[model samples]
Target: MKLLVVEDEKKLLENVAAFLERKGFLVDTAQDAEDGLDLALERNYDCIILDVILPGMGGYEFCRFLREEIGSDVPIIIITALGEIDSRIEGLKIGADDYLPKPFDLRELEARVRALIRRNQLRSEPVIRYGPLTYDSRSGVFSCSKKELSLTSRESSILELFLRNPGTVFSREEITDKIWETGFESRSNIVDVYIRYIRRKLEAAGILDIIQTVPRKGYGLRRLRDDG
Candidate 1:
């Protein structure tokens, strides 16, 4: 498994990264949230170890941005000196999967990381097949008729949402809410644009009319013929 540790404390960061590396995990370290965000966007890690206090863009904001703005679901464990109930609640409430107070044992932290990753794994369906389209959640790969289908990150996320909910129709606004942060322009036609992109890709793969559009409603994935 892979992990990212973002801590401003020089010694603590080095020690944690070394320990995780020794534990057979590919560990990446960052001293601040900005660099942490860069690494996060660049690579997919099984879990992230974050520190609350930092030089710029505190951990809380970083977590929020990762979840809301970037639409990431990677598990986060916040390590902070604030051990109060309120602080813990705020951490989870803002998208952290787990929290650990500073001065914590390295073993317990490892346990928490493993548990969170295990829980996330159990919560996901390994492979979802709808008609000729198949999605592997673990690999984040989509295949049509046993052939790999290439998709951009945002496009894949949108298609994954539809595949997971087979019969549910997602209105434009609903898709926007689920995919983009609240600050996105309400009048933007990005949702429709993305739907068009996805449809074109599916069509190129010989999967036609998979994305059904309701007149006044929005879009949904409907089974075609006996492809299911």
Candidate 2:
């Protein structure tokens, strides 16, 4: 599993990364929240280990920004010096999966990392099987019961995002952020055209039609069997 360790303490950060790497995990480290957020946004990670005492953007604000602004559901584990009951409660309240205080044992942290990754994988499977359609993320392949259908890069990204957050509304801005990184030229019809591309590809595959528009909200993925 891949994990991102965001901590300002150089020694603790390296130790955590080395320990997790030894435990058979793909580990990445960032010294502050800005770098951490950039990594999280650019690539997918199984879980993020965020330190509370960051230099630029504090961990509390970073967690909230990720949830409310980015619309990411990646599991988060907060590391903090404060072990008070209230502090843990606050971290959980802000959408952190687990918390490890400063001066923690490596073994305990490893266990928590394993648990979080297990839960995260359960939540974000690469290939989703729905009825006769299959969405394969690893190969960027999609298929129906009979034939394979090719998808454009943007189409694949949108479809993958929808499957991960099925039944959840995604704002237009959120979709833009996921697909187009910073400095990409923006156009009005990009999303609409991409939606059309996804529709046409699914239609060609003879897959069940389940993608839907939420009027003013944005695009959402509806499972063929779970249409409401």
Maximum-lDDT candidate: 1
lDDT of 2 at 194: 89
Candidate 1 lDDT (Cα, 0 to 1): 0.87
lDDT of model 1, residue 117: 79
Clashing residue pairs, backbone N/CA/C < 3 A, model 2 = none
Clashing pairs for model 1 are none
- TM-score for each of the candidates: 0.56, 0.55
Q: What does candidate 1 score on TM?
A: 0.56
Error of 1 at 191 (Å): 51
lDDT of 2 at 154: 78
**Tens-digit lDDT track of model 1 for 86-171:** 99999999999999998999988887887787667647678888878898887889998789999999899889878866788888
* Candidate 1 lDDT trough over 10 residues, lowest sum: 177-186
What residue runs in model 1 are displaced by over 4 Å at the alpha carbon? Answer: 127-228
